[model samples]
Target: MTATKLKPTLGTLHLWGLAVGLVISGEYFGWSYGWGTAGTLGFLVSTLLVAVMYTCFIFSYTELTTAIPHAGGPFAYSLRAFGPTGATVAGLATLIEFVFAPPAIAMAIGAYLNVQFPSLSPNVAAVGAYFVFMALNILGVSIAATFELVVTVLAVLELLVFMGVVAPGFSFSRFALGGWAGSDTFSPAAISGIFAAIPFAIWFFLAIEGAAMAAEEAKDPKRTIPRAYIAGILTLVVLALGVMMFAGGVGDWRALSNINDPLPQAMKTVVGDNSAWMHMLVWIGLFGLVASFHGIILGYSRQFFALARAGFLPPALAKLSRFQTPHRAIIAGGVVGIAAVLSDGAVNLQGMGLTAAMITMSVFGAIVMYIMSMLSLFKLRRSEPQLERTYRAPGYPLIPGIALALALVCLVAMVWFNPTITVIFVVLMVLGAVFSKLVRGRGAIDPQLATEV
Candidate 1:
């Protein structure tokens, strides 16, 4: 049977929405967890370092996305630069990043909702969210993207409202009262906390690169993709800084640092617990989680479909539905996410809580993808100088070099600080390699289709 292709229907707006929506949830929750690891001051330093890495990474990654313009994102770039093995590794890492992230976000969503409705169980709510969003995704890409755009716009506005509400209470003195959180100045413990905070700091901008995965379905990807990526990253940087500063400044950062729903908790300090603003935050904040949860589902589906179409995964996963959506891939990813949520009890390695542990694993995947994609960018520039390119990364070698170096540092920090998750990541990589080899050995992939895009 012939493979069905994703419909090209997305414009720059949809791309922007998806890009922002895929990561907007970070503004609401995960990054605050960094405060628990490194305290306010230490996490701030970590955030600054991570911000630099992502800025450089996005600029460099844009060139690859525009030049290649495939749905595989990093996988496509690595496939062109380093062949199938590289593609497999990149694809698996992308899967780990995209697939694992939603469950964590879903848990946050449940926690936010449960605060509003004391009767609701977080796990049940999380599972329900998966089903609802997965169904929305299978409807059609345009419809799904339109939903993404709407919810993302609302989510962005809510964050601004949050900043405004909390701004009146913002106090530099309060923010710094326990900012260092007992970590000695320049001591080994302080140094270790900063490194350990790297993953949570990365939570601020983890999946912004997922924008490139929609290239195949985006209108004029060369122009649209680059613009969306640049615009999206800038928007996120502003929001991340705004939310972090205001949230910590308004009240005790320590109180909300380890919670799944930090924004609502932080807002509670400025507006009393019973205030309308607090209620608004809990209810409206759910949209932020939905935006990312839905958008990432769109992203991982495309990544799965691309890898399958390229012969790296089972051919069935590349199959499209009557609506021209990657229904199989979407369902497959949903299954994995649901399984992660259900197995939360078993997967809470290192006592970081399920959400934190999952975030660590996702960050681990992201670092690998970043390192490989940057290497692929360098390889492609050296090996295919004459290839067509509409846009080149502004800083070229310097930007990509900086990104690569930082990604390596983050990887080292992640392994050193979170050994349990690191071991799990290694096992996942090995399993992926074995599965890829077995599938290829069976001649299950169509060579013609593999090279089509």
Candidate 2:
């Protein structure tokens, strides 16, 4: 398979937009589910822990991104450190994380739209979103990146607006009510609840590292990636904690815990149901979901194109269009996401909706990818000591060590709490291994493509 190159059109601002836009949706909706499992206070502890993990992980992960500057991101890092098998595992995990995440964000987009148009079906709206964003991604990287920047800025401003509008109503008394896992004092149950809420807390900063996939398209990537990643994580951490705290304090936190539109509900308590601010939360808030949905489309397509170029997936998917974009790969991922949206009611787990289940599954892939990425960092540090690294992870081994240790704890907690999802994830990994083995047996592997970066 011939290696196709992505155009160098993204700069630090575009990279920052992609990094934050790819995850800003988490601040909009899914993290509220953590409140259901761990109440406000318990979930707060969970969020803090996960935030620390992401901060350290991004710091360490930047070393690999700058040295390699590959569109394959984690797959390329692992390939350089390990071999084809490691690359295959990382590729599959990344595919799952990027592909599954869009469908969940799409559903959130649809739900927000449905609030305005009561007659619209959310599933239909979700599939429509897949069609529209995939087209935008296929047009060109610069256009897509520009759109991502505008929407991300709008999304970030809306969150700030939300906080300002609701601040007058925020009270410590309401926030502390049932804060410790529904108990006045912390206990073993509260500890268990914090562990169980790990996946939800992780939802906050899940895809910030996806910007690494755009490094090949970056001008002077080594300088840009670190700036984008560090700034993006810091921005997300502040917004996430602020949004969660204010949302919880404005009303009965339990009331906002189980729903998709927690921000709107939280705003209702402060401004009433018919207030302009409440409407703004539902309307402008769509930008957050749109930003994430559009950015992930770009992310997943690049991963698909990179995998296909490296002979892990069908080479046909690596073909560039007249516009010099991975049109086929973009469409392929959209098809998978649309199919998931169509099968919404058919596959339900633990009495949760398809969106929640998809979030858990995506988090499963993200955790696996994180583990492989950190391990790759350590291996490359020892094996290729001469590799050009424009940015080195601060605190060396200790920072990444904390990230890896926290990721392992979260993975164990997720597997214990979501046994069915764990089985499904394992089956997917096994299938990926089998496919890689068969491709190798047929002599379809391309060593040149693996080292293209």
Candidate 3:
């Protein structure tokens, strides 16, 4: 468990990149799926509600990240507040959230590529992404972070370009067509659709909290985390709403609802499929997916390294490579994601495609982790009042309370709508619990590591 520390090479900009990049793929593809279930206006309502939760959650969660400054993130906070069992839940949830997310983004990356190259297979591109990014991560934290910053900037710009290109064709009349759960007027079905759309709404900001996993490697985390998180959330809110509205307005919103590459398809409606703008969006759009996919690899590997270092998982995963990166942990997560990628079509859930199913499962883990994180924030406030908190959550009880309540509601809605994915998530949690218990009983964890947390 005694491994080299993660190098502190990340600053405010790098943290912002990681924060936004971790969830930017949501802007590109997955959130549009909400359109399928909720229609344009219904999914817009869902997005606004989830946006409030994340805005509050990030503000409150930043307090923990700054105070604890651990690679384990929620796991570390839970360990300090509620001990091993809480840590186990937070750790596994974080793991599941980070691990499952990339495959979804990777699949989107492949889909975006397939739009450009007619014969290319999405599965092949998705699998190829795992190897390329894992190697970049293994080289060094600074290099990985610098690369992340570059791609994140490009992705942000591409989104802006997309909005500009589609603005001329935007028609509120078109967007409102079947906008309320496939109905002109709101009804019981609209309510159900909004609830069912919660997971996809959450997809818009799912891994923003994963930036906390980089706390251990951040320069002056207490100062950097707040600025990065607040700015990142604001940036995403603008992009998510803009992309969804503009895309929905150009022609039939329903056409873009269920597919993986919504932006390109939406753009094709304005510019012909052969237009230069269409080609550019397809090419640059990959950066959005690549940003999230690459960033999540960094996020999940840190969780694996942190859990293993704490003796909650295999000790071998804690080892750092010559580059001071958690190479083993990175590869371990990549293996799981690649497996999910390979099983894309083989394991279908209801009528959901592999990407939609994975997005739901990832959101399931995220909501659990969000609830646990808010609980930890409350517990720590009461138990460790003296702990140095350079940045306090602005509203205290109100802000975190809102975050916790909304997270619970999202969790319930997701479970109700996606029963099969819920069962699979629960089973994974149970298996992780058993594994953690066996690992702990063997006294495999270092007492020093426990004391440090």
Candidate 4:
């Protein structure tokens, strides 16, 4: 049999999958797990801040993507913008984030699937889903992309139901939120509670900037990218915050905390014990979870495949499919994810499974790269002013500058409270730095790529 590589164009299903994946994994499941129903208001406010910040960043990335449409997103951009050393470090950190993310998300899917569908064993369901994800990758990007669109629509519709009709029925005045203030559950509740509950506030908006990674596959790098980015982000926010607020208004903080899955439990109170609606709503939530995991797996596999192709990881990990997709890399990435899930399932490991730390590090790494990329922009303007730009950042220095500063602050805040994880981030940085140099001579990115800007 002969082989073939699938040629994908911009603004396709694969592109949509990349963006929608970020929103669901970043917002829907991430927030619900961290902040709980009672913290809806606070979580929403923080998320709004993140959303606005990331939206601007996405625009900046869109401009970059249009200028250079390729598979390796930040790595490609950073190398062009920054010098070799700088870009290499950024790429490594990004690779870490994308690689580790699959397991964390897969684990979450396992937990939630168990919660909603008690019939299937969690491990079996998780392992099955992981394999299914691998198969989906092999089925080709066309099928995967279509699934992304369907999943995205389902997630959005579910949110509308929760917020539009159900949320407004309850009184917001009755909600009490003094729990974090006056409570005395001193046993790891303060730090761990925030870390544990951090899902609500932190995970809600994890890797939104990853949308730019799929810019090459987007319909129109200039138009579809920005519009879809705005619409997609807004859709998630309205759903997550809206449903959360509905849940909060329907019941008090005490009631919300007691229920692990706040959305369904809260809906039951508002709907007057309607088991049918609860079951339907809970099933939708699970569907959203599945969609999210699907999206995350896509991102991780693309990253792994992309990095491997670029010569960062092993060459065997970089092989492409007859369909032009990175089949071997995707399968390898899925296996790693399955392993993480299998181990956790056996040991009963819980609480977002290194997600908190992974997110913290990824965001921090991205912020650092953003700062470097911005600086690289200036360097490019000075060093290679005549270079062509397909899409220029609207407010080059100003907008990029603000993004850099905000990212720095976010990174700083994460480090302030998360020393344990911060140290590990340091170790990853050192290790990635070393690894980048190892591939520099032959397989790694050409130093000239960085200077091309």
Candidate 5:
């Protein structure tokens, strides 16, 4: 049977804003900054390479975005490039990255705020942030996209201004600080210990492709989604490279050695006791990351909605609002969020259910999805030679091949670097596979129910 066509509804600016704001400055960079600062100069250099690798994989995603330009984003691309089962697997992997990221970002809001008001309970901050984000998301995506655009602009402005302020003040000598073969952390088992830290370095850009998942809702998705995906990735390149190179130059490794904070430590040195202005800057940057997470939840909900509608997940999740919004899917995403908040004192999930845990599962999922996407990019080029592409992936075979290689390395590194989370990720993948079989055997995820969602 010929597949039904579904287009996404986001515009260029909105899609780009959603991609850039949430992915570049969101929790990944915020958290990675802290982790990077804790390591030595050697580790910092390697971390920068990871940032480079992220851009490489992004080239692959960008190609897919331009080619498919449909609602399911990666899933849809894979479906067209591969098949249904492949699409579901890709969707699951993409789902892993974000399903927990929003909650984690909300928790980070509490943590970042805690730096100022140590006594403010994380529970209150998380719950408050979650509800606000939820409201923005449910109000229809355009509102959230606009908010993200504003936040992304502010964030990019802040980071750029901060870098400019520090640029002329930089000293190249400070980056010569020492470290071993493994990352900055030293022990008999240093190789794995340092590899374990790779994710923290790469995490900054984890949510970059999120907008693609919501491509169905993107206005003129073919045009909008591709631009958004590229712009979002470029945002990361500017932000990550800007911060890394800028930090290494202007900030002394001595004061920054014990601290994992890029901006705080830099502010302390440069601003030097200008407590008022530094606090203002830090909070703005921090909150910007927190606020942008609305994009992540937005993407995840749509993916689940697509899955449900396509007969993979529970059909009830495919319900739409009067205005055609996937109200049920959005709410279902939020419900898990409420549970996550209530689970372990609000912030505990950031540790237990986050990057080293569920979030890293997302990283693994992204790798799997990315590799498939690379293959799909290649296949589509051959399968539909006549299909139009706005932004063809530069270097074609070489670009896609490198992206696939980088994806494999990162996955291997993730496993070697983070065995504990690695095991959990494999277990989850197995479960997803098993569940896929179970759902298929059940005959259309619930055949008794009407197909009227």
Candidate 6:
């Protein structure tokens, strides 16, 4: 079967919008959960460290993205460098990262809407969000990307507005009050808290790499992908710091530490629950969640399309609509996300809320992808020195080396702190491997197509 090609409608700006839009929701929720585990200061330390890791990782990852320029992202690079097994692992990890994130974002959207309409159940609203965004995605890639750009701009502006509204009430004393809630300075427990906080810190920049998944759809990808990746990371770092400082400093950080709508809750300290700003925040905050929810659905559809097109997943998922979008893949992914939402609502396993558990699982997948992608970069550099390249990772050995070390640290920390989710991730990987082997036995995958861009 011939591979289905994605429409090259996305430019650097669209890529930037998708990159930032894919992660802007992090500013609104999830990161605060770190405060619960590590306190304000410990989480801050973790965030800074994770931020550095992302900066280095993005710089290094872009080299593969630009050179390969495939919709599969890390999967394509790993396949080229490592082979079928490596591609399966990389593809499965990509699935975990992209597939698991939407349910969490959907839950956040539900939570945000619930703040306004107390009558609406969060689960119902979350399911509703999945339907709306998935349909929008099926319409077309250009339409979906344009929508991502618009909502992303609105989301960024809203965060700035939030900071401006809460600027007067920002108290350094309040921020420092719980900076070391559960641990002493440099104590073992403090150190543990910092490590335990890694996943949430990762939450701050998670899925920005999903921008690379749009490579096949990007115009002049070699030039456009790098520009988008660089600009996106810089924008996120600034927003992450600004939101963290201002929100934690507004009042008792503990009050909003684990809440879904931390921004509005923080604003409530200054504006009161009924204030116009609070109402505006509750409404506008949904845009942030929508931006990510919609963008990630876009990301995952392409991932599913890539995997299916390569025969790693069922070929039906590779089918494109008349609009030249992966409509089937979008719908398939939505089904999985909806199932996740319903399952979490029913079980509430590990005593962690649906959003938190999903985030943990997603971060686990991201760490695995990071490790594999960096290794692929190192392997390809040595073996394929003569391959055509429009861009090269700056700091070469040093930058990717730092990214690999940090990713290893994060993986170990995750296993130590989130044993259950780690186990789940491992099981998922094993199952994916089994399935891949079965598919391979049937002679489903085209070896040449699997490794080529």
lDDT of each: 0.90, 0.91, 0.92, 0.59, 0.65, 0.91
Give the per-residue lDDT of model 1 (tens digit) for 1-453: 675677789999999999999999999999988898888888888999999999999999999999998999899899889988898889899999999999999999999989988899999999999999999999998999999999999999999999999999999888777666354658777778899899999999989999898898899999999889999999999999999999999888889888898888888888899999999988888899999999999999999999888777888988998888999999999999999899877765887888998899999999999999999999999999997889998877999999999999999999999888888899999998899778777777777766655
- Across 97-215, the per-residue lDDT of candidate 4 in tens digits comes to 65556666655566556766678676677678888877886777667777777776776677677665565567766443543321433434433344334323545555555666665
TM-score, per-candidate, Cα-based: 0.98, 0.98, 0.99, 0.83, 0.84, 0.98
**lDDT score for residue 384 of model 4:** 66
TM-score for candidate 3, residues paired by index: 0.99
Candidate 3 global CA lDDT score: 0.92
Least accurate 10 contiguous residues by lDDT in model 6: 443-452
Worst 10 residues of 5 by lDDT: 346-355
Give lDDT for model 2: 0.91
Q: For model 6, which pairs clash?
A: none
Compose the digit string of candidate 5's lDDT tens values, residues 1-453: 222233354689877777777675442234443333334444565566666666777766776776665556677777777776777777787677667666656666666677678899865877787777767777766666778788877777777767776677677565544433343445544444356556666566777777776665667766776666766777777677667656666666445432223465676666664566567667777746654567777778778776666666766777766545677777777777666656643333224443234345556777777777777788888998887887777777786787777677777877765566667677876787677667656666454221221
Global lDDT of model 4: 0.59
Tens digits of per-residue lDDT for model 3 on 347-394? Answer: 779789899999988999999999999999999999999999999999
Per-residue accuracy of model 6 over 206-246 as CA lDDT, tens digit each: 99999999998999999999999999999999999999999
Candidate 2 local Cα displacement, residue 302, angstroms: 0.9
| Ranked candidates, highest lDDT first | 3, 2, 6, 1, 5, 4
Worst 10 residues of 4 by lDDT: 345-354
**Model 6: residues with Cα > 4 Å off, grouped in runs:** 181-183
lDDT of 2 at 219: 92
Local error of candidate 1 at residue 393 (angstroms): 0.5
Stretches of candidate 3 above 4 Å error? Answer: 182-185
